[model samples]
Target: MLYHCFLLIASLRSVVAMETCPTTGMPGIPGIPGMPGRDGREGEKGEKGQPGAVLHGGLDLQKGEKGAPGMMGYAGKRGQNGEPGKSGSSGIAGPPGQPGDPGAVGVQLKAAFSVARGTHEFPQKASIIRFTKVITNINDDYDTESGRFRCRVPGAYYFVFHASLGNKLCVLMKLDQTLIASFCDHRYRRQQVTSGGLAVYLSRNQEVWMETKDYRGMRGQQNGHSIFSGFLLHPH
Candidate 1:
């Protein structure tokens, strides 16, 4: 006994130091959850994090559903012709046109004539002074057996004559073979009375006569002392 083996090694080191010492007591009743362990191999992507701090005053957002019509865009190059517009001020004048219908009733042209000389003969050089007294040949345009007047209406006439010379005469008045008027009485055994006139413009069977350059006098008077007249002063 070496002192009874040192008191049995000091009572087995005080029972192994009270079974390795760590016991503050009461926290041991939660342990029956254990079947979730196999998922741990995905961890390397973390270094880009520093930009998120500008959000001041939020809360007002309910109006957003109109967006589905966008696919027709390739036609834009026709824009260079627009500079000519400044002339507008003049419009007001229309009212007055209605009155037309009533016309047709004219033509009444009536030429005239009057003749005398019923022969006391003394007119025969370039002779054409016949007249057997008609005294008013309305449109029988005078031709008392060809002492001519013939111009059955074409314009401006008015001829006239009156001669009753008794000796030397020389009258003329023609118009076709034109020499409109003349008269010379030469008094040789005078019994004078002479006259002549004209205002011609005939054309339409044109004639008109009274020619005796000098085949001496004439005194044909049955109250009409040698005459010749014409009229129609209008129609052309």
Candidate 2:
């Protein structure tokens, strides 16, 4: 009986295993890690990559050395003229100049005449009074025969005349044929005196004389004298 029971139990276990395993048991514990592997061989150099993009951020570089001077360039053409500038202020005056040399001596020009009437005689109308007496006659410009003065020097001259008149007198001083001055005096039954003077510019060879406008009234010698006088003021 004991042997048979043992056999029966073994048979039951075998049949149970053969049919299917019971629910699986819990997993086993993990194993420890292995030693590290050695490094692999370096790879082959890749083809030159495309140029990289410019990076803003980079290491700062040192300053570069100074460059050599360049060659001289050709001269440029002249530019156009600019507008006129404002005038400058006047400068200070300069010192005075040196004194000049003295001038040469000049020639002296002289002409003068003075004449008086000697006799008391009535003169004809429109005729020159002939003064026979001569008080002074420089350069002999006055002619006693014609009773006229011919200008030898072109100049300004001063002429004066005085007449001793009896009854009535009218005398005219003339330059050439032109009347320059006149004097008339009338005092009935009484003696009187008349005088005239003029300053004239005369050219060379121009004539001057005194004449009576009327035939009457001249007194000289015993009475007051009639005189004509002239002198050069300056040569032209």
Candidate 3:
């Protein structure tokens, strides 16, 4: 029995070595890389996630190129009128202007005349000697026939006169019965000449003229040497 048992055990050991067992086999040469397996079935569709947040406080983005303008839209309805605005406050007053310069000198009222008529007589009472010739009479204040100048204004006036006589003669300048000036012949001569002048302020409508109370008559040879003249220097 003992001999049989030993034989059997040795046979069992030989069988194990020759036969392969799944779990205890030697690793084979790396497999011929496997024939690839089929792709897995597609996965189920996933749920949509929440919206992302807006980024801030980062480097500035470059400006994009401008886009083409859009087509114009239709005109809109008219709007209601707006209310009127309130009036503004008044501004402060400005400074006063400077005074203007004195006005220019007034129009000159003046006259100049020469004796043109022949020598004529005069009464003992003062008589006017007519100066028939006129050199200039502004405003026509002097009358050659009347031998009078009617003052048109109340103002200072200047008068000048010259008389020429064939014989002894005397001539006087009267302003409204007031003898303003006079000239008289000095002595018997072929032509005696005398001249007189005056400056006086006369009221409106006062008269001035040449006159002689005691002389036979004034004499003039119809020459410009015998002259009568007056002018307004300034008005009151």
Q: What are the runs in model 2 whose C-alpha is more than 4 Å off?
A: 1-108
lDDT of 1 by residue, 72-181 (tens): 99999999999999999998988988865544223247778888888776667777888777878875778788889888768999898887777777778888988877
Off by over 4 Å in 1: 1-107, 119-132, 139-156, 162-164, 167-186, 189-195, 200-218, 221-225
Report RMSD for candidate 3. 21.8
The Cα local distance difference test for each model comes to: 0.79, 0.84, 0.71
TM-score winner between 2 and 3, please give it: 2
Residue pairs clashing, model 2:
none
lDDT for 89 in candidate 2 is 100
Clash count for each candidate, listed in order shown: 0, 0, 0
Residue 180 shift from truth in candidate 3, angstroms: 2.7
**Top-down lDDT ranking:** 2, 1, 3
If both were scored by lDDT, which would come out higher, candidate 1 or candidate 3? 1
Each candidate: RMSD to true structure? 24.5, 22.3, 21.8
RMSD of 1: 24.5
* Per-model TM against the reference: 0.23, 0.52, 0.48
- The prediction achieving the highest lDDT against the true structure is 2
Residue-level lDDT tens digits of model 3 in 1-236? 99999999998977885685534567888867778899999999999999986546566665558999999999999999999999999999999998865543344444333434434433234567777767777667888878898888678888887666655667788888888777776576665676678888888888988786566344555542466788887787
